[model samples]
Target: MVVLTLAFVSTTLDLTLSDHARKERGWALSWSVVRSWRALTAGTPRPRPSAPDLRTFDGLRVFCMMAVILEHVCWLASLSYVADARYSELTRRDYDAMLMTNSTLVVQIFFLMASFLLAHKILQQRRKNLPLMKTFFETILNRIVRISPSNFVVVWFVATWMERLGDGPLWKPLVGGEAAVCRRKWWTHLIYMNNVIYPDDKCLIQTWYLAADMQLYVVALLATLLLRGRRAAVPLLAGLFIFVTGINFTLACLWRLVPTFVLHRPESVLVAYGGEPSFNVLYQSPLGNASASLAGLLLAHLHHALGDAGVRIADHKVFRAVSVLCAPAALGWAALSPRLLGGGVPHPMAAAALAALERPVFVLLVTVALLGAINGVKSWWRTWLSHFGSVAPRLSFGALLLHLSLNKALLATRLQPIQLDRPHVFFQWFGVGVLSYSAAIPLALLVEFPTQRLYKEVTELINKYKQPTQDIKMDT
Candidate 1:
């Protein structure tokens, strides 16, 4: 109920702000609604530090995390009909479409922002004399430790439960059927190589994002190593961006010419297409995601070079205002361009144009939002958002692992009917929300927490084992 209400209210406020007549009133009402919503949902603001710096980058991270959570919540609510028959009558395509689009866009924004922040951190660490290769391995290892442990627990639970529920034989082929692929590839998931094989595949739901992120990190790390310091970084990144953009445009053209390239394989198409050419471009394509990471690294380099002065100028009021306005406008363009090109049967030229427009527009919007959020406006609301951003788990990788399993679990148990057919949809959504949250939290605490600890321990032990050999060589 809380998630649905907040989503509805926030969306309503967003719509109202778009209307000139309602602008002023809407702004006021929106804040008021947010205050009430927070009170109802979280119940008592977390004790905060006075004059908290409200780290903008952290705030953006939190936003991404929450956006993903909300996206999952919306998805679960939408799927409530799978478990229970009552929800069948209540399902609405339009509502589901809206939820899916909004969730997808939000997740994209999160990825873009994350890429930028991570790149900046990586560059900074390199400057501090950290071995780039060592840093890269550590980074990937850390991510695995942080994400995989909790995730594995969830997977085990869901898989075991499904077996009990009689969904199918425990070991089926891992890559086909509606839910069959996930069942089969359970081991592939454990190793985190799912993205390499089928980058855009969503059979295991959110797991696709985890695989994509890992692949992009590897690519970005390699590019950074080859490019070296600040001098080579910009051109290398820029060239790579252009190359990826071209590839995407070409793919989009192919998609248009041979609709079969996309339509024939719906699952593969969504996974592979990603508004770009090449199979699995969206999921496994280094261009789309790596560019954002590179952009972020550039920003971080600029910050180090220019110090606060540089950051201040970039975050100047005028620059932020412009970015804020432009970001949404760019996103709006990307979203509506397909329709403007003509919905049903677009001309080849029009389709190509639309496809070409998508990559740049998405990149621009994401870049601007990152800049603005990092150094735009500060207010109580922004502060609150920053808090959530700080506290939300860096467990997206883990969350992705668990999401599909949980969805299947819910489906097998027939729990969705309660939400689907209830007289008050919000109430039903609340119940499912509780169930999902209950399931996720424990897994997070028990499995994820210990796995991260073990990762650290293992790393330390390896370092100790290697140190004595170095000492012996020195004595020699």
Candidate 2:
């Protein structure tokens, strides 16, 4: 009788345990499905990977962010400061300052940042033997979802409400026209093809950077796949550099396009692209802007290699010398750039040389300097700036999306012109930057931050399930 009772109790426990296991699995699956649906419909899975921070790079970002705001301040001030004067007519100092402001080069820094971060993460994943195709798909999706929501906020507001906000001389051309263009071509901005779809000032004029970034991101995925395990990284990089630079050079010469940023174009370059100064299709396209990103890819490889080898190139005199020289080189090129292009189209060879060398040159120089910082050499000011920069991981993208809208609103509402060349101009720019940043914070916290968090959570849940599959050896 006792033995019989023992057997029955054992059987009961077994059934209960089995039942519990089944229920657990079902619950997990259901939860995963719900998360997936929510992520797909209402949010996206955010990814937060554990990676070392390159602080100087962070500092560089801070500097660049402010530089962009300052550039626009001067630009807008030039337009509004002299209420009755044409912007085309400029004083000697204004002209010289305009020619020398290389602030727009900071845009290239954005592409470099994106490329470096993504490439670094991709190579790290590859080391864990993650499926390349799956990773490639996820990376692209992640990028799109990450950038889209915040982008849509700005795009939607511009199209629907900005024109109604205010009116000035700059109002109709800048606001009303932009609203019309965006309302009509919002899809292009949604997909990051605004630069290609609508060439002129319709929609967010500054979003060409975003468009170029997304397009180049796709290209990077393909490149990452091709260079898996670093097998083809070198040759692939070489070919990409040669091809992208060669093509840009060929086209610049063909179109007689100048190499300066839109804000500081040489007169001849202006006529070449029909007076729309800035990176139009010929310069702003993914094809033209890709060399900077490719250089970033190469830098990523070098960064990984240095980590594995545990060596600091900055310790070597020759390498240190090269890194030190980068600053002066960049400054020198920027100052002389206006002279290089002259008033009209430069000599064909000169134009070709500037176009071919411009991107890769700065990228290489910047990488070298960045490499030094990564290896633990940093100035005190750099350290401080980096600390400040690290505090706002989401700020840059937020500012990029928000600043233009803010600028449009401010420029449109002004009853009088902004004073462009006054001694207090620097303070005015500082104020504008503060306002831009302040506006960006809410967007970052509410829209950008939440979306990123949702993405990370869903991704983690999905990966948790994927682990078991990953652990099982597949038949290759």
Candidate 3:
């Protein structure tokens, strides 16, 4: 009713008021929104952001993005035990082939990429001498706007509409928990607290990431403020990184926690093993994931410092060898991590320490490897990877938001889950990706892209107004 009333009033004022009066009453803001909507939907569309593009970075994003989708597809398929009798067969077939379900590890890459790009951008802004307060809010709020509009629409649908659209042996189980949680605590997600409160009853299941990343972004920006224009920034950042590592070490050692996806196991596990096994404690907290983002930030700082100093790792054979080896080493480490820790309790004390250090270790390996890839290193492997990665950065977020629900919707409509096979899984992944990307294109264009432009224009307007006011005050 409030929304309707606001819509009515805005339309009425637009129809009834003069331009000057509308401007005076701040009705123009509403009309500007109207115009933005029209322009986004019908006008010349804005171009993709043209910041210095690193094919390797974007390309890596594309790879990780697809990996995330594939991971979830495999996961949700495994869960069709809720509907299909052959579920164990399905799981055995996939597990029979060694498909691990702990795909949540891809999120660490995302955290790193997000902070890496953000650090680079904010460093540019600092070079331009952007104000600290404005920079902080603009950085944080821009991220919110980027994710929230589509998130709100999706959450609303999940809560109010998703279950009603389908009914089956599978539909209730697949959608029920998520729908119930969103109905109760969607606001927590809106403000990045989803992981902290009743995390077992997670709404979208995937959104724990957004929450952790948002919390980390706030930390990153505050740290950025401290580092701005400081000669001692690197040392200070290193000190902060050590402090964060210490905190994570303390948490792991205190609880002897293992990192596992909350969803991969039966919901019963969440109840049976409450404290350390609880998703909220080990997997979902900002502290649990802080190393990846901070590592990315540190890498971004190093990249910037190197660029300013005219250093090129690409031409150096030793650096190139290290970069070449880093890729397989990271991949091997991740692939072997499960066996190293073995996905259960009673890990060796060494394994516990490895679990704590694994995150930062993975961060180092990836950042170093990708830095070489993105830095024009002229490697054939990078060239091959970059081909797929170039568009990943833009499309990845949209795909992430769309894929989980798309997977649910697809499964809910299935009369019976198919028996698992390599061929079947491949086809399922390909088809779902096709549909998800198709839906994501318009969502990105109509909703995500335009809101970003409108936001940028608004901030530019604020800066414009502030400059004139500053001039007036100075003259006075």
Candidate 4:
């Protein structure tokens, strides 16, 4: 409930500011304010050459990361005092309600949006003599370097702590045993393939999404390469989406037939595939995520095509109104659909309706919102949202890594007992959330920033060496 409330508030603020900015100021001034508000809020000047528009995507990325963090924190807190069975039925009911409401599908919207924006930038850069392979390889390498170091640090901490605290053999089916597991399959994590085999047993529980994202990245890069020309891009992307969706649908059917074959067992089938164990086929399969990634690719292509026309569709009042309406409508359907039908008996029509209201519809709504945001939604609320969006990339990825890890640490510590029934629980959670953010700020400054810089430096050094050798060969 806290998480939802916060999300609602933040979103409302964003919209309100956007509308105000649009009404009060011209597009140029509104855009300027939106882009530069972070600097103003931070008490600094907007830097020269301006921050990259990719930064806007990063802002959204940070928001998603924060949402995931909150969801996990809420889950951890609910299960914290599970050993105490003395709680009332109402307490248990509340706990279940909180858990249900903490779902992270909302985060997936930002993920898809980021994919779209990033793919757009990648395609744009490709036109300027950039080798597609080099870009693709570099992207993979950067993700590895950026994500793995902190991840491994957390894994090491968790493994050591759990072993000491449990004081017994730690179950490690994937790695054969506790001691040998880290050494053997750690490389799998480094390469982001851990989800294929070790879906249930993760090093850092959230890293599954990292692996999924990496897989999506590879597929997107390939698609971008195959459909580089203007005329071929849309048709190719549409074909790819259909192909991937068909594969996902087929896998979903298979998983329904043989339930255990899916990764993460039954739950994976439902969440990933869409409910029945048969859905597991589609659920565990990376193709669905790849389809969303492709959707993002298409969005990028659309942006470029529209950009060439020098017209901003987002600026149109009708488009903005439609995009704004989609989000609430999707949410309303999601909230009421289950209850209206009564629980249990799952008909095909009901299942299909639920699936329609899930991630894909949410993704479309998010895409519309983003388009409106970018195309000149002038308002103070938008200015504020755009500001947070600007700061998002700088701290978001690191925050995502640290916040959940901190929550785990807190759980492991077994802090002072607090009554969840009390209103103060919200304040306590907020304090913890703030502390997590505070810790993440420095980690972002020290670890994430330095690591990214080092990766860039290494790439530059390699390129320098390769360039001279290439020049020498050409002279000969």
Candidate 5:
């Protein structure tokens, strides 16, 4: 409450301050907290540079985040002593259940976009003859700066104060239990290794994605650096895809792991998948999840390569047709994912094949779709996604961090078991989405944006101080 109050006060002050006053004061760390709200509340779109317009990604990410939120709502509903105890089991037998089950694929889009943008940025830097080592360090620094402060604050809040919000029969075990584990194991999250070290004992289990992503980021950067030239890049990326595919296939077969988290799981394990070996071995492993990131890197390399050669994909009818066809194919694949794996019990070969191909195939199709959209594939769907999906992405990361907790809090406060139906689950999702995004606004304004602004200010000051030394050296 105190933190939220401070954020409100700072945002209010930021709104009242004039432009001149802001320019004079914005550099101060304290004032950056206030000035951050200007961007948050701004009506204008941020200007784009010569780089590819990724506003489309903003929409993609926001949509994925909402889908994940809806999944969590359904998950929590399944966990509850629901009025309709059989709903989870029966729902899985339907076609629409595939939508919820395969929605986990949306997470890969984030992984894909991360590597794609990283490759794109590095390619641009290479054109300007930037130092690879310097760019590498800067990338690490910027990622940490962007992600850590808000993450730390959220972790601390969950650990210390979340249980204080409310209490019920399940509050202690569901809410307080998590907080207690966080009190002891929070360092794993801060270091971004909890996914590897104790895959099950998590402060916020959903955050395993962060650990996987950070680990993959380092691996991708290192690979990009070592295999710097175009000659080495092709074999390196292709070999990486084959290598990761083999690992996923081998692990799935050896461990008999489920291909995806939502598939082949009993109704009892719906909520957290707490004791599921598949969750530990396949779901959280960086290597297991590398296909999407690899797909992103591959697409990015091609994008830059095409741009350098003055080739527009849209100009080629064949390429455009293939790209346009990917959208429906991807949708159909997702919708029938359960059937693809043989929903109840699959043959060993089929399960292994699904593990090997699931992410790569889906990611490839989605990457193609993304390529089309970016390269001027016009459609009403793309138009809607671009416009409506842009702004919410600003809050998407914060919402991701907080949504599960909000869902848990809501359920923890419930005195009666929820009626597990589509309508009720939708209502839960709606309420949780509002609460999560509402909480995220203050979180972003307070911690995330201010930290970014302060980091930029500090870097600028250091750069200014170094300029004279560089000039003097040049003169000498």
Candidate 6:
């Protein structure tokens, strides 16, 4: 209620601003629903080298988000009372089930991307001679402002109105159960400690990624500052990656945990596995996942250090061939290795090694692909991604917040058990993807963009006041 009301009032004020006032407050006009909608729907053209846009990631992020929703869709379907009791189990035993089992690792791409963009932005800002401390504080503030409004709206909606929205045999347990958790532990989310503090009972369980990302962001930022312009930076990142990987390996071995989710677990057990000790202690831990963040920071520095020469190397025929083969191979190995390791059988040492290397290998491949994209590698894939670059990136964050809730609502509203099959699951995913992105539009335009604009305006006003003498001198 509060979020919607504020969005409405802000939109009205922005739209009603007179031409003269609008001209004077041009940047502030970003609070306008009209402009925000345009930005959220437009397709941006490819930019020249000088453009600041990371267009490659726009489609990548949006697609990755959609995939996450699909994963949940599959998981939820498996959890629900399906017509065929054996469907979920049979499907998981199939060789192709590796995709679903390993899909969780797709999130590593996001961790890498977030840190990569942050490091890149900080490096660029540093070139303007800004104080490092100011940049650090501003970065933190900006991230909070960008992420919080949509997040708050989501959390608030779940805790308050979600149960009222739908009901069925499964509604209370599926949707209301989560809402109950949200109401009790919403404060953990506000502090970005939900993942660490309450490993098993997260309100929006998918947001464990956000908590891990936030924690890693702070650590990565501090490391960036300490090692800025230092030659030892790469070595330190390498060491961190190894250290994090070792922790994952050690914990997986000690806990006798699988490298990834054991695909062949009973459908009932699989659904409840999220709260299992393995996931809480190791799987979602920032320490276990820090390698991806470090990888991102390393990639950003390497890109900045390499410049155009790196682009030439990426474009080389030999290098391109090797990359083409190597990247997919790495992903394939990460996807299939756990299943090949006896499907979480009593091979603790082997499972431990797989757990340790699975994400790192995937992150390595993603880093290579990102490097290629950043260097403007020509491909049909890159071209398709660029087409949606303008709008999707803006909505990706909102979609992340809203998709899970939306999916649960969709499932809970069903009057009967769904048929569980690949085609049915795919159909459900298509609907969820369309609806999730559609729902995200309002959240982004109303809550996320407006909050960001308001924050920027307030910061600029503060800076203006702080430099009053400079402004007066300029006027003179």
Candidate 3 regions exceeding 4 Å error are 1-53, 82-102, 261-278, 341-351, 389-392, 460-476
Q: Judge candidate 3 against the unseen true structure and give its global Cα lDDT, from 0 to 1.
A: 0.68
> What would the per-residue lDDT of candidate 2 be over residues 52-80, giving only the tens digit for each residue?
44665666676778777776665555444
Q: Which candidate is the best by lDDT?
A: 5
Measure candidate 3: CA RMSD.
5.5
TM-score on alpha carbons, each prediction: 0.67, 0.79, 0.81, 0.71, 0.92, 0.92
Tens digits of lDDT, candidate 3, 1-476:
43345445555675677888865555233433354345344522222332233666666776777777876776677666434435543453233233344445667888888888888878876768877887788778888988987777677878998888877777777787678878999898778788888765768878888888889989888887768666666666667677877787677677665544322454434232334343565567888888788877887777777776778767798898898788767766655555554444445564446557666776778877877876765667677766663234566777877788888878867886465556677888888788877777656655565556557657666877899999999999
Tens-digit lDDT track of model 6 for 1-476: 66566656656766888889876675566567876776667767756775333676888787788778777887777666788877665666565566765777878989998999888877655556667788788778888887877887799889999999878877998899889999999999998999988676768888888889989998888778776666677778888888888887787778766556552255434455555666776567888788899999998877766662344646588656655565566557655776657743547677666767788888887877677767666666666766674666777887788888888888887888889778987899889888888888888887787777778777777777879888889999
Weakest lDDT window of 10 consecutive positions for candidate 1: 257-266
**lDDT per residue, candidate 5, 235-344, as tens digits?**
56868888888888887788766666344355534445666777777677788789888988887777777777787777788877887788778767777866866556
- Residues 1-476, model 4: lDDT tens digits: 43234335443444556767534432222223222233323532343432223334545555566556655654455544533335522442243333334235555654476477567667667668677788778776776776776666545545555434432121222112332444456666767786676554445545656777778777777677666656778777778766766665554443333311112222342232234333223333355466667668877876676776677676688887876666456445334434533444455544444332344555665666565555554443345545663444555555665565565555545535435443434565565567766776545543454455456556666787799999999999
lDDT of each: 0.49, 0.65, 0.68, 0.53, 0.77, 0.76
What's the TM for model 4? 0.71
Error of 5 at 305 (Å): 0.9
Point out where model 5 deviates above 4 Å: 1-25, 29-34, 42-51, 227-232, 261-264, 267-271
- What is candidate 5's CA lDDT for residue 54? 68
- Which residue pairs collide, candidate 6? none
Better of 2 and 5 by lDDT: 5
What clash count does candidate 1 reach?
Answer: 15
> Higher-TM-score candidate among 1 and 3?
3
Assess candidate 3 and give its TM-score to the true structure.
Answer: 0.81
Instruction: Give per-residue lDDT, candidate 5, residue 277.
Output: 71
